[model samples]
Target: MEVLGRDVVQEWECSRNVVPSAFDSHFHLDRSGRVLQVYSLERLIGHAEGPVPEVLVQVSDGVAVFCDPATYPEVYPCAPGFGSAVGLHPKKPHASVEGAVRLVEEELRKEGVVALGEIGLDWTTPEQEWPLQESMFVGLLELACPRRPVILHLRGQDRYSSEVSALSLRLMRENTSPTQRVHLHCFGGNLDQVLGWSTAFPRCYFNIAGSVAQFDEIQRAAVRRIPLNRLLVETDSPNRRVQRKWHNTQAYVGEVARKVAQIRQTTLDEILQASLENGRLLYNL
Candidate 1:
């Protein structure tokens, strides 16, 4: 039995929440789900009215706000589903971070946006800009703490450079609160740390992506240790665990979700119901 935040996703990975279904835990898109802002007078009216850019459409889906913007799309524009999170990407420009957040907050005020981001520190990139990253991220947490759920972006897998770990720990400490919904999406850490955090933080959820889908070794020897309820899934797109295509798409969330169910050894139907419930629980849907 896989346990996640007291919930579970069984083996065979169910399909309650799919394209035809009304729920999804997490999803994204780069071009379409983007909140178009009237940034420059130089590129005004025409840019606003033209057919919305089609980024991740697969001819059978409608995109929704998610932790990864790369998963959101233009064409089949998901028919506005519920239980989601949205935010500026870590690698994106400073303007994207600042501007997209402003828009997201505005959307939250309107009940459109759910999470504060895919905002957090990345050890995978240059360290010289750590302070800039820390500063901007704190701003996001501060901004988001009172308003919406936070979709976190944490990278780096153990054994050195404590800087990333330190930064991440600091952010977690500073941003946490009673009401905020925090999700450390696509998480990576040793088994002890994962369990520690999962035990310590009841509100947080983690996404198991990439190699974890097929039992690729993570630093966590007991990767399956996390419960079915605390567990979530994502394609982390453009690249796939089962197979890769030209780009990653949200449609594969189900495929990955199923793998997660199998690891948990629960029924797909149970996984489906529980995953949707988990999403609602995290995002307050």
Candidate 2:
């Protein structure tokens, strides 16, 4: 794995026109049981039309989180170059919280595991199951915090309102340490949520994915204000569309970087380079 440091940043600074290969901060290797279809390194680079520039096809590396513990055996060995995370997703109701935690603990002992999520709170599920989700989330956070970085998956009843992120913030505050490394996967909250997380966990990183293209005014403002050093980008492949017309493949990660640059009013190289570095440190690559 090629690691970027100060010298590379200086090289990029001197060569402004040079485009960097993107590190997809969060993506899934097992989606809908078509593991081979989604996990290939070749498929990560998309050949598409529209806003994606030709230069972004070279996706050098990424971290693939297999959130479901049941699929870990099939997904882990197949991913050759990518790092991975293993945990129980809040929305996927497991029969026993202890069994789920033990399964994740076994996977964490494996060779390529790097983080412990795509796990957190989601209010979109049945209201009755909220306690079960909280128990699983609290257990996983207790296991991973201050030991490994966590990639969070938080959602509310609707995009316009996010009580779930607030709920997640409280759980994290009570269970974890202040310096835990966190990646808020596909963050859609407003500026206040950003400030809340940053204030609580100084090492937290907010990831911007295809969802960046659809941000409302306040969400866009949050993107604009995210500290350059604290920003990261992801494909979240096989999940959400990068745009209304395009089915998201890792190849269109450039489109995501483009949207962030447009929102932050910075150069594409700057976004790409900064995100690359942030992803590296967050995953300890």
lDDT of each: 0.50, 0.75
Poorest lDDT segment (10 consecutive residues) of candidate 1:
3-12
| Residue-level error in angstroms, candidate 1, position 226 | 1.9
Residue range 1-285, candidate 1, lDDT tens digits? 221121112211363234233133444434322333322212211121222212111112221444343443222221334433466566653654566557545544543455677777775667676666777677677566734667777665444224564566566766676445567666655566566556556665666655454454554354467666766655454344344422333434455555665666665556555556666666655
Off by over 4 Å in 1: 1-23, 31-63, 66-80, 95-104, 157-166, 218-222, 238-241
Per-model TM-score on C-alpha atoms: 0.66, 0.86
| Candidate 2 lDDT score at position 68 | 72
Cα TM-score of candidate 2: 0.86
Tens digit of per-residue lDDT, candidate 2, span 1-285: 232111122333454455467888887756623632444444444323234443343566678778875677653633534588887788886788887888788888888888888789888888898989999898877677675998889988878347888889899989899989988999888899889999999999999988777888989999987889999988787656566554455656777888899999988889888888888878777
All candidates: CA RMSD (Å): 10.6, 6.7
Which candidate has the top score in lDDT?
2
lDDT, residue 280, model 2: 80
Deviation from truth (RMSD, Å), model 2: 6.7
